[model samples]
Target: MPTPGGYALVHDRTIVAERRTCRFSWVLVDSGNNINILYRDTMTQLGIEATHLQPTRMLFHDIVSGLSCSPVDRIRLDVLLGTNDHFRRGPIWFEVVDLSSPYHVLLGRPALAKFMAVPHYAYLKMKLPGPKGLITVVGDYKKSLECAKAGSKMAESLVVTEERRQSTGS
Candidate 1:
């Protein structure tokens, strides 16, 4: 029998983001999501001060648990996609949230639409128009598998902990 959080392996697409003085990799491409999200830790790592963030009253929901989440703030940052020879750079508004995720940033449909990008989940690739030609971003299968494993482990641990709490009536 399949274990909890151990379903069929799903291909998770990732991309690289380049800014003026920093570069980040393993940014999750989530087509089902409506907005882009930046983890708080990633913001700190990028040396972005909290004062730079703009206040927001938007609330988002977790697709799995149906839990509502309020973002800490929002920020507009220039994100460069693709290589030097072929790339697209634009300002993206990201909702900064405090959450634990395998990826530092989650690019949703909004970002994809801004870039006019198309993603092929089966092939683990995304393509967009670039200055020179079409820029194709390939995903790392090994990294995807690793992330799946880590997520599964985390979910299993949560279930075990919940069961223990219930048994102890805590």
Candidate 2:
């Protein structure tokens, strides 16, 4: 069942992380990430101090487009992941990456392992160990489709731009 603080939309599943209400589609479970990733814009919005972050030579491979990405910096933040009094896991580490993505944040294997979350993609649901016992988060199939379409369009545009740049040799 969906908790009051975190609920599934008619079109998408959303979670309340800290004080931010985020789309589940925005957070993906990818072991490759190793650590959680927060988009530059999101970091700014969260008012996270980035000056002290240590620079790391980390490369991010986008599963959607097979493109390589690099992080601008890395920061350790107390990331609370949960809703209400049910459960909360956090103050976790996250890498700051400057990339144009449809999602604001991506929660990788580290966060998953921390939360012991088991995702069931077929049912668009994920169950995690919560303070109460077990909690489930449902996804929105339609919203996921929308995000994919947008991401695909963005990828095509980037490819076209790159091709034009190479042809023009500018």
Q: Which stretches of candidate 1 lie over 4 Å from their true place?
A: 1-20, 155-170
- The reply for model 2, stretches above 4 Å from the true place, is 1-25, 31-35, 62-66
Error of 2 at 107 (Å): 1.1
- Per-model TM-score, in order, reads 0.79, 0.76
- lDDT for each residue of candidate 2 in 66-152, tens digit (9 for 90 to 100): 567788888765544445566565555677888777766776777678778776655667678777888776666665666677778
Clashes by residue pair, model 1: none
What's the CA error at residue 166 for candidate 1, in Å?
A: 9.0
lDDT of 1 by residue, 99-125 (tens): 666677778899889999887776767
How does candidate 2 score on lDDT? 0.63
How many residue-pair clashes does candidate 2 contain? 3
Global CA lDDT computed for model 1: 0.73
lDDT value, residue 126 of candidate 2: 67
